[model samples]
Every structure is written in C-alpha cells, then in structure tokens.
Target: MSALAYSQLPNHLQPLLAKFYRAHNSRNRIRSEAICWVARRGDIVGGLCLTPVAQGHFLTGLLVTPPERNRGIGAQLVRNAVASSAGPVWLFCKPELVEFYSRLGFSVANCLPATLADRLTRYRSSKTLIALQNDQRMMPMPNATLNIAIACLLDDCGRILVVRKRGTRFFMLPGGKAELGETPLQTLRRELREELDLQLEDDDLDPLGHFQAQAANEPDHQVEADVFIARLPRAVTVQAELEEMAWLEAAPCERDDIAPLLRGHVMPALLARMAQAERVACCAATSDQGEIGSLAGKVSSIASSS
Candidate 1:
C-alpha cells in the first residue's frame, strides 16, 4: 500500500495511531516501499508499517481500530512486517502488551546499541523511539528514575547470591539509593548492613559496575544500577529489612537476569577487574619465587666469603 493511501485513513484513526506511536506524523511521513503494508478494511480500519533509519530497523504504527480488534488482523499485519525485515526488529510495548507480541514470536529483548532507555537519556526528555503493541506503548521519558540493586556475585565457585529487594516480590540485590550526605559507597555499605547484616570496610567494596534496567515491578520507573563486589562472610545472617534471599548459579543471573545498562557498561568493567586480579596474582607469585631463589644465592655467597 502506498504511504499516501495509508495517510488518507479517517481522521479519528490518525490520533489513535499517533497516541500509540509518537513517530506517526501525517504531514511529514511519506511511505516507502521499504515499509511493510497499510491494511484497510474498506475504510482503513487498521494499518502496519516498517521504518528503517540509521540507528536500526523499527516497526511502527501497528494499529487496529478499537471496533475491529481481536479478529486476528493485527497479528497477520505484524507477521508480514517481521518477515520482511532483515536485521534485529524492535518495537516499544507497554508492560501489559508484552504477552501479545510474545505470542507473535516477539520476545522482549534489550533495545541494544541504542534502545528507548538510551534515547531517554540521550535526547533529554524526548522518547527517541517508542515501541508499540496492541493498545500499549513503551514510550521514553528523558532521565527517568528507576529502583535497582545488584543481585549477586558469580564467584569462581559459580555460586550467585540473589537478594530480594526489601518489600518487593521481585528479587534483586540488597542495595538501595544514596540518602542525604551519602556517597555510592556509603549507600552500599548501609544497605548491605541493613539487608544482609554484614559489615564491610572501604577496601572490601569492589566496584562491580553500573547498569540500566527497567523497573517492571513498578510503574513508570527505571533504574541505572551501580553494582559492587565484596567478600561475603561465611555463615552470614540476615535482618528483617530483607524479605528473602537465595544462592543460585551464574546461569540464572546471566546478563539477561540483570538490567540492560549493566549488561553493556557495568559487566564489561567488572570482567576487566577480574582480569586485572588474575594478572596481579600471577605477578605476586612470580616475585615470591624469585625471592626464594635469591635467598639461596645470598647464603652460598656468604659461605664462599667464609
């Protein structure tokens, strides 16, 4: 369908599309063959389109009129669009519409290299990209705040200690935001002591890294989490502020289990620290061995002097 014909849809339906997709601009948007189809039921009851831009491929304006929805037209339109796109296809959807796209073989993946989250931060209060699904839209709000925590540290033993966020069913790390007059380090220590009942000195706090995550457990909130690594004490006890805790392996808390910002920025830094630690150990061991050999030579020299 030509972009002109799609643009000619009834006036009322235009706002519906625009509401779900902020990118829907009737005057400015000209249709490209690169875009998928613009389906109309006699009077243009529904439409779907694909827009390819420099950042990545985005599916937009998948709309079905309120009266004609749930008759399988929307799914058919989306399926056609997905088949045409080559690279990673992404669309924004609200918390409610996650299942609808999932059933259509669209699992919620991180909007990577530049997602709605990144755009919110970059564009400064404008939603750079809005994902659409059914009646819901995952629109970006600039510099949105989120609640977050570092769940666990995957040690050499492959054990991960997942902490339950205080007073939430969703499990996360035992940490909280910085209070008045508290640095990130101070906030972490206070939170750890409050939730896990462990005392940690400054040296014990290994800066793990920070990550971007959606607070799906809460409405209209997101988080940029700063994770840290600490030596967990044996037989650690917990306090009431912590709801629950568990120790799972690395597989469950893989990058997917954490927030997106952490996956890209925070995890890389943590991995680099791990590498640095290994290098330091190797250097220390070599130095010790050299010292032992030098001591024996010194004793042999003293005997020759005698």
Candidate 2:
C-alpha cells in the first residue's frame, strides 16, 4: 500500500525485485544508476524502473504479481515514476499495452531517437513486435516555433480555469499567441478579454513563470508560454470566445487531454502556490484566535476586578 524509492526499500525487497526482473527476462537490464519505484502491500507486490537513456528516461522492468495486476498498482507506480522524472519519459510496452500507455499521456511514435532505436530493434527481434503506425500528422516538423501567453486562473474553490479552443481536444490554460509589440502581461490581458470576455487588471495577475513545450495546436512547433495566475470570483460566468471553458482541479492523472506545459510545469507551480496560500491563511486564523483569547482574558480580569 506504499511506494518506496530504490534506496529506501528494505533489503528483503531486493530479492523480490530480482525475481520479478527474472520473470520478465530483463534481469540483465538492471542498473545501479536507475531510479526504481517499488510498490508494497505487506510485501513487495509490484515495481518499475526508470533508467536515464540518451534520449530521455527509459521505463523498463515493470511487473506486478497476478493478484495485483488489475488493481491499478502498476499504473500508480508508473505515474509516480513519471511525475518524479524531470524531463521526457519513454517506455517500451507490448503491442496490446500500447493503448494503456497512450492513455497515460504517451503518444505512439513512428520513429524513436537514435538511443531508443537499438533497444526497439532488440525488443522486436526477441518478441513478435511490430512498429507502431507512423502518424505524420502527430509528428512535429523540424524548426517550427510558436509564442503564447497563458493564464492560470483559479476560482474561489481553488480549481483552475482551462479552455478548449475550437477544433482542439486538449484543454489548456486560457490565453493565446502574443502580438509582436505586447508584453506577456499585456498579451494575457488581451487574450483573456478577447477569448473569455474576462477583464483583468495588472494588479490582479501574478507572474508565475515562462515555459516552453510542444504546441498543442501546431504540430512540430514549440510554444513559449509566459504563465500568470489570477483568482476568479466563484460566481463569475466564463463566456467562451472560441469553444468551451471548464474549471479543472489540476489533477493530471484523471485526464490525459491537458496541455503538456500545464501538465508538466504550470500545474505543479499552481499547486505549490495553493499550498502556500493555505498555510498563510491557517497561520492568520490561528493568530486571530490567539488575539481573541488574549482580549477575552483581559475583559474577564476587568470584570472580576469590578
């Protein structure tokens, strides 16, 4: 019922992991440099390893006991490994498992990087593996670029505001491409007003950070995003300019339709901010209660004296 890092795992679990690797015929692939996540219920029930490869990180040696297979333990282990990873993550799974991984936010690539190509060949030669259909439409062309300014608007209940543009399935933070002469804030302000009919002043927006990711709408181009945080009133109505709007809880695992930048970066930052704000509010509430207690004590003393 708990997940542990490779180093934090007890000595007793190593033999179990080795057995799992042996069962998968991947015993030789274990590396000390790799990060492993082990899931345990009483004892080790499942595990997965993430090794640093030239392309990014390669996921390997995934295993779950028969009893634990359908219970989602393997999925949780993979999710934890991916969330902990800093950069791109890659994995090689059986053809049947392609849909499983795809639902976890990995696209089936027609061609892999040079580092993964050799491994793919080895895997195919060993097993009856076929190449995933090369989808040119999903592949980004070389040397493409896009610029966007995105807003991270949170409602009173702390859910984030995300908008899905017309004809696109991915729901991303509200905002759009920046104009040539506009600052990031200006771009966001204009985009919000134009896209959502929501007016924001400079004081209402807090600069979160700048990030770059594969553009959701434009294939082969990277979108450089300047992200900002704004708080929306609970009663505000969002009038969509392009398609539709929804308040999202920033939960990445529940859905795979979120934009990459938001899933990988912006959501983490927003979550951190939410935590900090909650802490501040907690401290203020405690301080206020302490002040009220002190005042109450003083009044009680005065009444007693009188």
Candidate 3:
C-alpha cells in the first residue's frame, strides 16, 4: 500500500472518494479547497481531508474501507497530515474513538475557533463526541529556532544513547542541524553515521514527532526537532565531532549533563509513552485471563458430562 497528498481535489478522484465515504455510511464529503491525503492499494482504501481554517486546518472527511481496517492506513494518513501541515489539525470524533486517536498523539482540545467551539457544543448536545487537536507547535517560531533531527536509540535495558560534542558541556541526542536540501530522516542518518558510527535505513526509524524545546548548547535559543526511535545493533564508539558517549536511564536521575531538549520535553514524552504501554499491557493480560477462565470452565463442564 502507498499514500499520497494532493493540494487540490483531483478531477478524477472526486466521484471515487465520494463513493468510498458512502460505502462506509458517512455523509461527509470533501471540498475542492481541502488538501487530500489518500492511501491506496490498487484502489483508494483510506483517506483524510484537511480544510484550511483561520485557527489551523479542520479535518473534514476520514474513512477507511472495512476490509482495510487495522492495517495502519488511517494512521499513515493522519501522521502525514500532521507532519506536513503548517499548523494544528483539528477533528471531532465519538467518545469511543477518543482512545484510538489518542494513541496517535491527539488530545482533547483546550481551545478552538469560536465557530468550531459553537458547532461542537451543539453537536455534543445531540451526540457523544469530543474535539481533538494535533498541534505541531508551529504557530510562532522562537528566537534562534534551530531545526534539527535527532534519534532516540534505546538499548536492551531501555536506556537512551546520548552524546557530547567536542568542547561542548551539554550532552544531547545523536543528531545535528539539518544541512541544505536534507529531510529529517536524511539528517538523522547522516548525523548518526558521523557521530556514533551507526548505520540505519529510513524504515528502521519510528518517527515520534516534531518537537520544540530549549536548545542544549546555546543560551536563550530553542530547537525544533524531528525525533525518531530505533534499536542499536551493537555498542557504539564516539566518532567525528563527538567527544564522549553515555547511556541515560529511561527516567534519567542526572540532568546536569543532559541536554535541555532531552531532559525537559523528550523525557516526559517518553515516560508518557511507557505509561500508556503499561496500561495497554495490563488490559490485554486481564482479557487473556478472562478467556482462559472461560475455557477452563467449559472444559470442566464437558468432562463432568462425559
């Protein structure tokens, strides 16, 4: 399967998309002005439409064919939209779906456009729905905002690999500033090879998101980072501009040497992800236990009857 984004609604895909939504029993339709992100496997299997608005971008129609559900097509569409969009992306969904979208980094919106706020109030009065927003933190750029791509290389024990550049006091994630004509993945790959003697393909990385935090080495500066997670194939040595390398605990206790970006923003996000994982695991275990008990009871009943 492949995905694509179209700035304008294509003339040929109009009817097909309309039919796609109808098959899913949705009445919402896409407008020509909205940006289109589509997932295709021989045909369109999933799609999400982004409509420009004063606040940011309002998502209009989102659908995935029944046969294509649980294949991560919807996630790809939403991730592409948020990463490529200039600002936040907003949507309304039923309460049951809140958990699904929340796993993709969406949260209940604290604020919204006056018109949308009003619309949500009226809609919620009649249905069980809530508003969500995915903020890219691009509304206003900070002073000396450096855009960098960084890696979150975790070890078998769940420790993160950190590096200190030559003559720098701060220890940061393994990455550097984006050079001319380079994407985030390109920057991460180049930086890792140069700094840590590590090699990786784009598919090896799981993009966390673009994040903003205080700059590590510079005073009164900020950094916008494209963060990713991947495994370390083997132990690494300091190389290139790196002077030292270290491993930080999943929740690091020492922060005097850690970079502000890692200590402040990245750590919190990581911890949140870990906590969510625990909750999911616990739920799955309980479900499995219940199923096991049911099977045992059935077996005992059959033995007694026989």
Global lDDT of each candidate: 0.57, 0.72, 0.80
For model 1, name the residue pairs that clash.
91-131, 92-131, 92-132, 146-222, 146-223, 150-173, 211-261, 211-262, 212-261, 212-262
What's model 3's overall lDDT? 0.80
Model 2 pairs whose backbones collide: 1-40, 140-220, 141-220
Clash number for candidate 1: 10
Residue 102 miss distance in model 2 (angstroms):
24
Which stretches of candidate 2 lie above 4 Å from their native place?
1-143, 233-241, 250-253
Q: What is the per-residue lDDT of model 1 for residues 64-143, given as tens digits with 9 covering 90 to 100?
A: 66655544457657766666555556776556777667656566554444455564456445443334332123323334
For all predicted structures, in order, the TM-scores are: 0.42, 0.49, 0.56
Candidate ordering by TM-score (highest first)? 3, 2, 1
lDDT: worst 10-residue window of model 1: 132-141
Report the number of clashing residue pairs per model. Answer: 10, 3, 0
Q: Deviation in angstroms for 194 in model 2? A: 2.1
Indicate which candidate wins on lDDT.
Answer: 3
Candidate 2 weakest lDDT stretch, 10 residues: 1-10
Model 3 scores a TM of 0.56
Q: Listing every candidate in turn, what is its Cα RMSD in Å to the true structure after a full C-alpha superposition?
A: 18.3, 14.3, 8.3
Write the residue-wise lDDT of candidate 3 on 165-275 in tens digits.
Answer: 999998889998999988888999999998887899999998665666678788867787878889888999998989988988888455788887788777777777778
Give the number of the best model, judged by TM-score.
3
Better lDDT candidate (2, 3): 3
